[model samples]
Target: MEKRVVFDGKLLPYALLMPQLLITIIFFYWPAAQAVWQSFFIQDAFGLTMQFVWFENYSVLFANPDYYRSMVTTLVFSCLVTFFSLSIALMFAVQADKHIKAAGAYKTFLMWPYAVAPAIAGVLWLFMFQPSLGLVAQAIRALGVDWNPQLNGGHAMTLVVMAATWKQISYNFLFFLAGLQSIPKSVIEAAAIDGARPARRFWTIIFPLLSPTTFFLLVVNIVYVFFDTFGIIDSVTGGGPAQATTTLVYKVFSDGRLGGDLGGSAAQSVILMILVIGLTAIQFRYIERKVQY
Candidate 1:
């Protein structure tokens, strides 16, 4: 029999949960509520007066063709970031899981990037790819390719995608490494004895077992790309030579800060929130069904 511990008082259990509940209410629920409320009103440049326009802000937002472009850009960015980050991290995690002599050292080095702030990561990548003074840019130019992210929208998008992927790889690597280690050695050995090559064993056994973790990470990486990469966009391209790298989150900031359209910005935020929730639901509803666990 398993021993169980219970709190003596009902109120004590609620008391223990109070702080977290309060945080959720204050930080998350309150801001969300405010955004929803504000989306219906148009405010002045100074935010001095607000006029309720119902869905005018949203109507205007939807009517703009650039909004659709931003949507497309966001979809492409999220897909690229999520796919590359997971694939690269899985590769590194597999290498680390092999019980190498310097495994601990390698893991420590790999995870260090996760600790670096997104803004800093963006800046680091900027320095490495910044057309004239950048070493990598110089090397690329040397190879007969004219690589200037500042002048080229495609180059700018590629730079930010690379930075975002690199920053997130450490996080995915940590989770992948843990998931890989949790698989039983006997299962792997049995697959090997059955004449399965390493690649076959991995695809048929290791990967299937790791599907739950993979699914969870997939959702997490999407959210990370949506919200956390805001700082990276700010520091690196600042939405680019054009609106090339401007994701929806950055578009919200642009409307509020640069454009001074508070209502429009609020509307964009609300839509972005809905978009994230919808994506998460779609993933859990469809993708989770495929998980072995």
Candidate 2:
């Protein structure tokens, strides 16, 4: 009886996970496979005819300057947003881990932004930055700085980065907070007893202990900046100031939904997926090994 009971217990988790496994296969894996299939073929307008072109889409994408620029812009956006979000999150997490008064309140407030939808956040930012009525624009003008997303590609890129970082900081902070809390209290106390300054302790102990969380956040944040937040780009800048803010995903959206270039959009999607997969594989191979756990 005991043996049978133990066997049942072992099977219970698998039973519970079956639904999620089925959903993943149906939704995630199936769609990915279909996308890969569609990438090499062109579909007729009525979906009646399909012909494989054998990398023709990829060839055209590579040959196009605009596609390359969009790819580069996406990479730059992901890197800058990840760097700034992680930096700010770590700083706040460290402060919260000290159990400062009102730290819970601070954390709650910081995380509230993440609860809001990205599209709504983009609209809110637009309201705050619009040239004629925006407080930020007025302040910039008052300071004698020419801040215009209409004529300046750099400013448009900066706006997108800023909006992305704002939405990302809270998510990163939650992870960092958990990482900080999981550090053994005795280890920190021992370091302090040895006359280790805060900076030294952080560099030699706390930061190292937090490496796994940092790495996880890095991957997730990169993926988020890549695929998500298109609404933010669209609402705030419309990929404008001469397409400076037109990241790869945004370009895919514009081509497919707006320009009716289904084949071209599908090709761009395949390229984006490949880029993400390659970057993720490299991270796991190199960065994961350096993480303590």
Candidate 3:
């Protein structure tokens, strides 16, 4: 009973696919190829000179202690962001799924952060955690705790992680809410009739049904932490406080755009791209096995 669209002609199919093919080539493949090519070369301070030292840039990058530190920072940031964003969003979605009064307004408030730009989100958090004039920062200091993100590396990392996690929560909430709504109520009712507690029903029945959605969000959250958090980190901390919040993506921008190390930056970009691709592959290979559907 499955009907398929049959192409009338080969040329017509090719013509229809041309636009997407051109875009992928021009935007993705071309830049990736250019980065790979440039990673092997050394460009001087001026645009006039170029030295082709194969693998020297990558070798120097690996030897640099700052690069390894940035890697560690990125790993920690990604883990924290992914965990907090997904878990918090799931919690909110669960609450909002209930038939509470003014539920629409509550859901709307929770979802509003997704519409805000990442830079704007970071700035908003920065204003509240400014350490000097910030309301939250003042309250924290009043608690007899020294709170200064500007001078403390750990504080700076915490600030960026909070901003990034907040920015992503709304996105994850949307998906989790949708996943929850898609589950059959009859299944939950049956579980309840079987004397299953609310928490047990959620974990054993509802959550298993949502495995596909959870798996998809896991991949998306990882990618978001890797690349999309650049704006938040840049606007809020600018990878400051001794590079505590300097992720791989931020390092690429800082080293190339600000430090003017084009070759090294390209190498970093290449490595970052490879790392993300490998992580995604590993997730699909191993993690996906646990997903019910």
Candidate 4:
């Protein structure tokens, strides 16, 4: 029998929940409420006047073709970042899970990137790939390949995606490694004894077992690419090369702060929140079924 802890008094249970409830209200609910509230009102550039314009901001966003472009850019960025991050992390985790000399050192180095701030990571990659003075850029130019992220939209997009993926790989690796370690070695041994090749064993046994972790990381990596990569995109591309790498989050910043469009920015933020929530809901409703756990 499993034991369950129960509070003796009803008031005590409510009291125990108060801290979390307060935090939710203060941090999450309040800001969300504020965003929703602010989205309806158009404010002047001088901050001296305000006008209630319900749905106008959203109407404007829907009408603007650039907004749609930003949407497509965001989708592409998120997908690429999530795919590469998960793939690279899984590869590293598989190697690290194996018994090898200096495995701990390898893991330490891999994990060190995660400790770097996203903006700093972006700067590091920028230094490596910048068109003018970047090491990789110089090499590519030496090879006669035109690779100027500063002036090329496609190059800028690729740079941001690579930086974002690099930032997230370590986090995905940590979780994947933990999930891999928790699997039963007996199952793997049995698979090997059954004449299954390593690749076959991994696909049929290991990969399926890691589905839960993979799914979780997929969702997290998507969200991270959406929100957490703001610092990276800002530091690396500043949403430039003709606004090609401008993600939805950065779009919100551009509209709200730079463009002095508070209502529009709020609307963008709300739409973003809705998109993320809807995506997660869809994943849980459909994708979760395939997860082994």
Considering lDDT, which of the candidate structures 1 and 2 is the better prediction for this target? 1
Considering only N, C-alpha and C atoms within 3 Å, which residue pairs clash in candidate 1? none
Q: Report the Cα lDDT for candidate 4.
A: 0.93
**Per-prediction TM-score, please?**
0.96, 0.92, 0.96, 0.97
By lDDT, the better pick of 2 and 3 is 3
Cα lDDT tens digits, model 3, 118-173, are 99999999999998889999999999989999889999989999999998999999
Q: Report how far residue 72 has shifted in candidate 2, in Å.
A: 1.1
Per-residue lDDT tens digits for candidate 1, residues 209-256, read 999889999999999999999999999999978899989999999999
- Give all candidates' CA lDDT scores: 0.95, 0.88, 0.93, 0.93
Error of 3 at 282 (Å): 0.3
C-alpha lDDT of candidate 1 relative to the true structure: 0.95
State the displacement of the C-alpha of residue 85, model 2, in Å, after optimal TM-score superposition.
0.5
Model 3 off-target regions past 4 Å? 1-5
Per-residue lDDT tens digits for candidate 4, residues 15-69, read 9899999999999999999999999999977879999998999999999999999
lDDT of 2 by residue, 12-48 (tens): 8988999999999999888778777777877665668
Top candidate (lDDT)? 1
